[model samples]
Target: MSTQVAPTSGSPSRMAQLRQVFFSSPIVAFASLMLLLIVLAAIFAPWVSPYDPTRLAPATRLKPPSELNWLGTDAFGRDLFSRVVYGARISLVVGVGAAVAAVLLGLAVGLIAGFFRALDAILMRVVDGLMAIPNILLAIAIVALSGASLWTVLIAITIPEVPRVVRLVRSVVLSAREEPYVEAAMAAGSSTWRILTRHLLPNTVAPLIVQGTYICASAILIEAILSFLGAGISPETPTWGNIMAEGRIYFQINPGIIFWPGLVLSVTILSINLVGDAVRDALDPRMAKRGIDR
Candidate 1:
C-alpha cells in the first residue's frame, strides 16, 4: 500500500513559507526594524524637529549642546540637532528618489534588450561606453552642464546609476528566459511582454533589491561630493553635504560643526549596508537549508 505524507506546520504553504523565511531570521527582523525607524524619522522630520534648522541666533552662536539646543548651534547659531533631523529628509529623499528613477528606466531598457538580441547588443554598447567613464566624473560633468539644483543633482546621479541597473536586469532576464517554464510559456504562444512581465520580472526582484541598496549608498555619497565641490544643491539649503562644506572652515575652532553631521551620515550609510547584507543573506538559496524549512 502507498502511504501519504502528512502536511505539517512546516509544510510549504506560501504564507507559512514566508513567515518561516522572514520571522525566523533575527538579522532580517532587526535590520528591517532599523530601516523602518530611519524611514519614519525621515518622513516626520519636519514635524519632529524642535526648531527651525535655518533660523539663526547671533547670541547663541557656537554654543555647546544644551536642553534648548540638543546638538548645539552652528557657526551661524542655527540649531544643529534640528538641522540633522531635517537633513535626514533631504538625504533620504534624494538618495532613494534618484535610485528609483534610475532603476525604473534601467529596468525598461534592460527588459527590451534582454528579450531582443539586436536591442541587447545596441543598448549594452551604450552601457559599456557609460561604464568606461568614471561614474563620479560623469556625474560631475553632467551637473556642470545642467546647473546645480535639487533636480539637477538627482538627474546627474541617476544617469550613471541607470546603466548599472540595466546591465544587471539584462543579465538576470537572459538567465530567466531559459528556464523550463518560460520555454513552455513561449511554446504555448505567450506574448513576449507577458512572458517578461509575469515570468522574468518576479524572478529578478532579489538581485535588483540588493543592487538598489548600493545605488542609494552611491547616490548619497555622490550628492555629498557634489555639494562639497559646489556642484550640487544650493548652499543655502541645509543638506549634509553643504553642512560638511561649511564645517571645513570651522574644523580647527569648534570641530563639532562637521563632527555630528558626518557621524550621522556615516551611521546612516552603514545601517543601510547592514540592512542590505541581511537582505542578501535572507534571499540566498544556500542559506535556506539552515533556515526553517517550510
Candidate 2:
C-alpha cells in the first residue's frame, strides 16, 4: 500500500503565514498605521472638529496657528482645523466612491470581453481609445466639459479608471476562463452570467482589491488637482485641493496654511499606496515568498 500525506502550506496557520508576509516589512506597518489614523480621523470628523467648519470669523482671517485654532484660520477666517478635519470626509468619500464605480464598470466589461471572442475586439478598441489620452488630461477634459460638481468629478475620475481596470480584469479573466473549473462549469451548462459571477468574479477579487487601493489614492489626487484648478467640488465644501488653492496666494505670508493640508494629502496618498503594496505582497504567493520568512 502506498502512503499518503497532506500537502504542507509551509506554516502552521494561514494567519501565521500572512503575518510572516504582510507584517514582515516595517514600511507595511508604517503605512498601515498612517492609513488607520486617517480613517479614524475621517470617522470622527464631527466630534474631532473644533469649530463650525462653515462659520466665518473675518477678523481671524489668515491667522497663524494659535491656541484658539490649532491649525489657524483660512483666507476666509473659517477655522482651518475644522475645515481640514471635514476635508478628510470629502476626500475619502470621493476616493472610495469613484474606485467602486470604476471597478464595477471594469469588471463587467472585462468579463464579457474575455468570455466572448466576438466582443473582445470592440471592447479592446474602446479601452485603447480611452488609454490613448493621458489619464489626468482625459479627466480634466471630461470634468471641464461636463461642468464641475461633486458628481461630475466622480464621473470624470471613474471614466478614465474604467479602461485600466477593464484591461487588467480582461487579462486575468482570459487566463481564468481557460482553467479546469471554468471548463467544468461550461460542460455543466452553467449560464455565462452564473459562471462569471460564481467563478470568475470571485477569483478576480483579490487582484481587483489591490488595484482598488491605488484607484482610491489616484481619485483623491485627481480630486485635489481638479479642485485646485477650480473644476471639482465647490470651494465652500473644504476639500484638500480647495484648501491648497486658498493657501497659494498667502503662501509667503502663511506657509503653514498649505503645509498642514498638503502634508495631510501627501501622507494619506502614500499610506494608501503602501497599503496597496502590502496587500499585493500578501495576496501573491510568489511575492510573499520573496518578501517573507520562508
Candidate 3:
C-alpha cells in the first residue's frame, strides 16, 4: 500500500499569523480600519473634497455645516473639510518621513558605535546630551535656526527622535554582538560588514518595527504641536494644527471650526497609537508564546 508522506510540522503561515494578530483584537481592528480610511481620504483628497481648500468666498465665510459645505467654511471661506482632507497628507508625510530618516540615520550611527568600542563613548555622550534637552525644545530650536517649513520641521522632529532610536539600536547591537553566532562568524574571518549586516542587523528588526510605530505617532503629534504654535509649515498650508490655530479666535462663533480638525487630529493620533500598541503586543515573543487571543 502506498502512503502519502507525513508533514514534518503544522504551523500557521506568516499571513495567517498577521491576520490572527490584527483581526482578532477588536480595538486594533477598528483602529486599523479608521487609520486606513483616513489615509485613503488623504490620498484622494482632491476628488473627495467638494470645494477647493484655498477658495475664498467672504459670503460663505464661517458658515455652519450644511449640504453645500459639509464641514463648513473657515474665515477665508475655504472648505474646512477639504483642508482637513489635505491636512492628513501633511501629517502622515511628516510622521513617516521623520520616522524613516531617524531610523536610517540612527541605525548607521548605532551600528558603528555599538560595534566599535572606541567610538561608543564619543557617540553616546553626544546622544546623552541631545537626550538631556526636551524633545519639543530641541525641535523648536532646530526649526528656529533652519526657518520653519516642511523640510525644516521634518529635520527638527527627526533630530530629537534620532537619539532614542540610536540608543535602542546600539543596545541591541551590543547584546547581539556578544552572541555565539556572531563570535563564530568573527572567528571564521567574515568581513565586519557581512557580520554586522547578516547577523546583527536581523536581530534589531523586530524591536525597530515596534520602535518605528511609536516614532511615527510621536512625530505626528509633534508636527501638529509645531504647526499649532506657528513654528511649523506656513500658515497658508491647511494642516490640522494650522486650521485649529486659525479658528481658535472664533471658537465661540462656531465651535465646529476648531472642533472638526481637533477631532480628526485626535482620532488620527489615537488610531496610530492603538495600532502601535497592537503591533508591539503581537510582536512580543512572550505574548506570541502565550497565544494572542488568550
RMSD of each: 4.0, 3.1, 3.7
Candidate 1 regions off by >4 Å?
A: 1-34, 292-294
TM-score of each: 0.88, 0.91, 0.95
lDDT of 3 by residue, 193-267 (tens): 999899999888878878888899899899989999998899999899899999999999889989998998888
lDDT of 2: 0.87
Candidate ranking under TM-score, highest first, comes to 3, 2, 1
Q: List the residue pairs that clash in candidate 1.
A: none
**What's the C-alpha lDDT at position 86 in model 2?**
88
Best by TM-score: 3
* Candidate 3 weakest lDDT stretch, 10 residues: 7-16
lDDT of 2 by residue, 77-138 (tens): 99888888889988999999999999999999999998899999998999999999987798
The deviation in Å at residue 166 for candidate 3 is: 0.5
Task: List the global CA lDDT of all models.
Answer: 0.82, 0.87, 0.89
* Residue 53 miss distance in model 1 (angstroms): 0.9
Q: After superposition, how far is residue 10 of candidate 1 from its true place, in Å?
A: 3.9
Write the residue-wise lDDT of candidate 1 on 1-294 in tens digits.
999987765534544435565577676666667667767877888887888889978899888888998888888989988887777777888889888898889889988888889888899999999889887898889988989888888988999899899998999889989999999999999998899889999977887887888888788888888888888888878888888888798787767778988887877787677666655655766654456442
On lDDT, the candidate that comes out on top is 3
Please report the TM-score between candidate 3 and the true structure: 0.95
Q: How accurate is candidate 3 locally (lDDT)?
A: 0.89
